[model samples]
Target: MTKTVETPREREAALLIKAAASLQNIRDTWPQDFDQLSKALTFNRKLWTIFMSSAAMEDSPLPHQTRQNIVNLGLFILNQTRELTMEPQPQKLDGIININRQIAAGLRAMPA
Candidate 1:
């Protein structure tokens, strides 16, 4: 029997999807599980932070434009997270969730 090993890209995609689902879950159960929002948002912020840092690295394999885009998107996500943290609004989660899912999809679609 042969076992397939997941590539780093696949792992990153999975993590992004997980983070999106966690945020969505907290949003869906808003008001009831407001505390959970902190956890979800923390995870998401940390993930994006890592991504941005990697993309910002000079040796990063991604194209210059792609890396810049990641950094830009990461900045947006961080700002959105800050707003959500202050306001605790359910609707504010849409952009973060959408970005995570979209980025994850793109990551997964790439040839590995």
Candidate 2:
């Protein structure tokens, strides 16, 4: 049997999906797993930071509107991450998961 290597967008989509799953797991555990939740959120924040930086690059191949949208989403994620860190609620992870999953789905649907 042979394994197929994923392309850049596929890899990114997979990461986003994994991040969403992590948040969902944290949500399922509720307030019982602060340590895991914190780590998951930190990972998500780092991922978003990379995405935001990529979107901000002048040489990025993405369309202007797409870049702007990514920036807006990154801002939302940053603010939500801060809120989640401060309040530490299971429900707080929901929006982040949704956004991540949605973006991941979109990326997956794009033509290669």
Candidate 3:
């Protein structure tokens, strides 16, 4: 049988699944060093937020509105991701983690 091509929504869902898997891997392979653990956590949280946002965009009813919202949200997520990747500061990590957790929880509660 020939392989089927994925639509944009399917591709987005695949990406989200990959990101979630990576997050779990990081959690499982937690580093003993405090700095390393912090970095891993920060990176995982950022990926999770992106994944959730992308999934949300996929599930949105109004395609144009969702695209616009994703563009705005994408900018914010990119800025935050940049900050997280830069210095690995506690405050930044905390903020990102909180937002990621909230988004993930909200997304989980949404009907699939």
Candidate 4:
């Protein structure tokens, strides 16, 4: 006989998987600047908390607007997650310095 999964448990598992994937993507993308990525992750967590809390509060005259704000915040968090996962790792200071020198040389060579 085949085993069946419960819908709630399945959804929970999927969410966990998605979170893990996001973490790994961020790690891979920002290997050198984990601090910035960590800050973004923390901000996303706070946004999620606020969204849920607002959703649970009693209805009011501004309930619809509040719900829309929550949705917009959720989307913002997701976009941040995606961005943190896509940014390339920064170069070392020495490498950055050398690149700046090269760009300066090229700019100086350009005609006015």
Candidate 5:
């Protein structure tokens, strides 16, 4: 059997998908696992923070509009994450998963 290697973009997208899955899992098993939900949300927030920082870099190859859009989305995630942290609602995690999945899909669709 052969293993496939992923490009940087593909790796990032994979991670996003994994994170989304984790969020979904937490949602599916909500209330019974507050600790896991908090951990998942924290991890997701960290991922978005790194993405936002990378997009803000001057040497980033992404177009200005694309970078700006990512930054805006990151800001939304940051705010929503904070709210979720305070309220700890399972449903609130859906928005983060959807955003991550959407970005991951777009990344996967891009040519290497």
Candidate 6:
């Protein structure tokens, strides 16, 4: 058996897409599915936290401006998650879902 190794961008894209799918699924079955909201949001939040931490690292491969942009975007995502957790609205997840999918698509477009 042979295993294919994924580049960092591909891995990140996969994670983001997975998080987005989880959020989207929760959104689809919301309130009745409220029990799952915290789990989904927590996973998404932790993923963004890891991204922010990596982007903030001094030795990160990303350029300073790009790293800063990622940190800022991560902050926005964190805030969005906080708001969603507080309110538990299905519509509130739209922006987060769009951002995740868009970022994932961009990551997937990058050359290895």
TM per model? 0.96, 0.95, 0.45, 0.34, 0.93, 0.95
lDDT of 2 by residue, 1-112 (tens): 9999999999999999999999998899886776797789889999999999999999999999999999999999989999998998888888999999999999999999
Error of 4 at 11 (Å): 30
Task: Give the winner by lDDT.
Answer: 1
Question: Candidate 5, residue 47: CA error in Å?
Answer: 0.8
- Evaluate all candidate structures by whole-model CA lDDT and list the values in order: 0.96, 0.92, 0.52, 0.48, 0.90, 0.92
lDDT of each residue in 1-112, candidate 1, tens digit only: 9999999999999999999999999889888888899999999999999999999999999999999999999999999999997888999999999999999999999997
lDDT of 6 by residue, 1-112 (tens): 9999999899999999999999899889876887888898999999999999999999999999989999999999999998987877899999989999999999999887
- Kindly indicate the candidate among 2 and 5 with the higher TM-score: 2
Among the numbered candidates, top TM-score falls to 1
Q: How does model 1 fare in lDDT?
A: 0.96
Residue-level lDDT tens digits of model 4 in 15-53: 434444444545556566475655545544554565456
lDDT of 5 at 54: 94
User: Under the 3 Å rule for N, CA and C atoms, how many clashes does model 1 have?
Assistant: 0
lDDT digits (tens) for residues 1-112 of candidate 5 = 9999989999899989989999898889887777787778788888989999999999999999999999999999989889988898888988999999999999999999
Over 34-89, each residue of candidate 3 has an lDDT whose tens digit, in order, gives 34544455555556566446646756564766457655655665576677566544
Residue 101 lDDT, candidate 4, scale 0-100:
40
Model 5 CA lDDT for position 45: 85
Instruction: Please identify which of the two predictions, 1 or 2, would achieve the higher TM-score against the true structure.
Output: 1
Clash list (residue pairs), candidate 5: none
Clashing pairs in 1: none
Deviation in Å, model 2, residue 65 alpha carbon: 0.5
Task: Please state every model's RMSD to the true fold in angstroms.
Answer: 0.8, 1.1, 6.8, 20.0, 1.3, 1.0
Query: Best to worst by lDDT, what's the order?
Result: 1, 2, 6, 5, 3, 4
- How many clashes show up in model 5? 0
